[model samples]
Target: MDPKTLLQNFINGLSLGSLYALIAIGYTMVYGILRLINFAHGDIFMMAVYFALFFVTLAQLPWYLAAILAVACAALLGFTVDRIAYKPIRNAPRISALITAIGVSFFLESLAVVVFSGIPRSFRTIFPQSLNEMIIIGGEMEVKYGREVIVGGIRFPVISLITLIVAAIALVFLWWFIFKTKVGMAMRAVSLDIQTTSLMGVNVDRVIGMTFALGSALAGIGGILWAIRYPQVWPYMGFIPGMKAFVAAVFGGIGSVPGAVLGGLILGITEVMMVGIMPGAAGYRDAFAFFILIIVLSIKPSGLLGRPEIVKV
Candidate 1:
């Protein structure tokens, strides 16, 4: 492959991987503390895109404000899902929580179809042209669909570049919140020992709720960027990406943050590189991620960065 095409493919991979990483972090965070995979997480990502679309088209709000509100709404939805769905099952068998998570995911998808209809919504028809300027390329181009950027004389879609930038900012802030804040400390404590942390005077439920909200916010940002890059919103849109992100979380080490990021990047880059190098096999792109996961798990069941679970006798 030529350097230009290879570089473009690499950027595409990074952009795609960043989206997975953002969503994967949410999965890992919930799993880290509760040891339950919140299967509804991808639906939360879907709702975020619809929320942004609604705010921008119906409310006629500016894209930036709409994005902020959409993220906030997504966070609230995540918190509510935890309280109403997962909280009641906290002490139940882990299987019950897992079943409930799947149920919640289905409910959200059905609700989206009922409300938003089965048709795909296009940003070009509904949103102002400013969405591309502010959200995609930032005044670099005026095209309605996709725009390219020339860096060192190689042209690549600006959406890929900007998506990476946005994901980086969001992830960096998340790292700071997780590592440097009081709530973060409480979160870590709870993750280690929920019962002990509760006994130590921390609000266990509150901390868990905050964790959900924070993780959902990342998904919202990722979802919005995803809609812009792909330029469509539909009920099932988040399903594959969400599943891919989950695979990324497991690949990186289910409960580790840095590992999620690494896994997502690797997944995205490899997926895109495959399509770029062998165009005929592009149809199998989605399956490639799981194939890689199978290989990784064969080598290290605990994942690339995950620690083995210890059982207390």
Candidate 2:
């Protein structure tokens, strides 16, 4: 392949990977705290995209403002979901919680369909027209202007830059919150042993709610980013990304923040490379992710970053 095409593909992969990482963080966070899958996460992501679109088109809001509103709405939805569906079953059997997650997932999907109708909606393009501008790189190659030149003329997308900046800020803030603050300690305590933490006077419920809110907020940001990159929206849009993000969470070690990011990048790069190397398999691009999920499960059931559970005799 030509250098230009190869460079462009790499930039695309990174942008795609960043979205996966954002969504995967949500999965990892929830799993870390509650050990529940929260199958509704993807649907929540879809809702955020729709919410942004609705605000922009119906409410006549600016795109940036709409995006913020969507993120806030998604956070509220996630919080409400926890309170209404999962809170009552907080002390139930593990199977009960799992079933509730599935039920909540289906309910949210149904609600989306009913409210938005089954038809897919295309979102307004958010990329600038100048996004396609190009600059001469090597004597034989040209690099797109949207791609940043950090050191040589090697090109990368502006979106990739934004993704990296936001992700880094989020990680820094998350690390601080989890390791430096009193509330962070309480959260860690609750995750280690909820009953013990409760006995120690920690508000387990509030911490869990905060965890969900944090995860959902990440998903909301990811949803908006996905819309910007793909320029399409639908009620079912979150299903694939959500599932893939879950796979990424498992691949990286479900409870590990850094693991989730690593897994997402791996998945994103693998899928992109698959397309690049096997042009004939372009139609199955989506299946590549699931195939990786299966292989990871078969080879390392505990996941790349997941800690194996200890059972008492």
Across residues 88-188, which tens digit of lDDT does each residue of candidate 1 receive?
98899989999999999999999999999979989532334543432233545553443666555666776787789999999999989989999999998
* TM-score of every candidate: 0.92, 0.88
What candidate 2 gets wrong by more than 4 Å, as runs, is 1-7, 126-155, 310-313
The sequence of per-residue lDDT tens digits that candidate 2 reaches over residues 154-236 is 65656666666766676688789889998878877876888898998888889888888878988998898888767788778
TM-score of 2: 0.88
Among the numbered candidates, top TM-score falls to 1
Clash-forming residue pairs, model 1: none
Which ten-residue region of model 2 has the weakest summed lDDT?
Answer: 144-153
Q: How much is the lDDT of residue 241 in candidate 2?
A: 96
List candidate 1 segments past 4 Å from native. Answer: 124-146, 310-313
Number of residue pairs clashing in candidate 1, backbone atoms closer than 3 angstroms, sequence gap of 3 or more or interchain? 0
* C-alpha root-mean-square deviation, each candidate: 3.4, 3.3
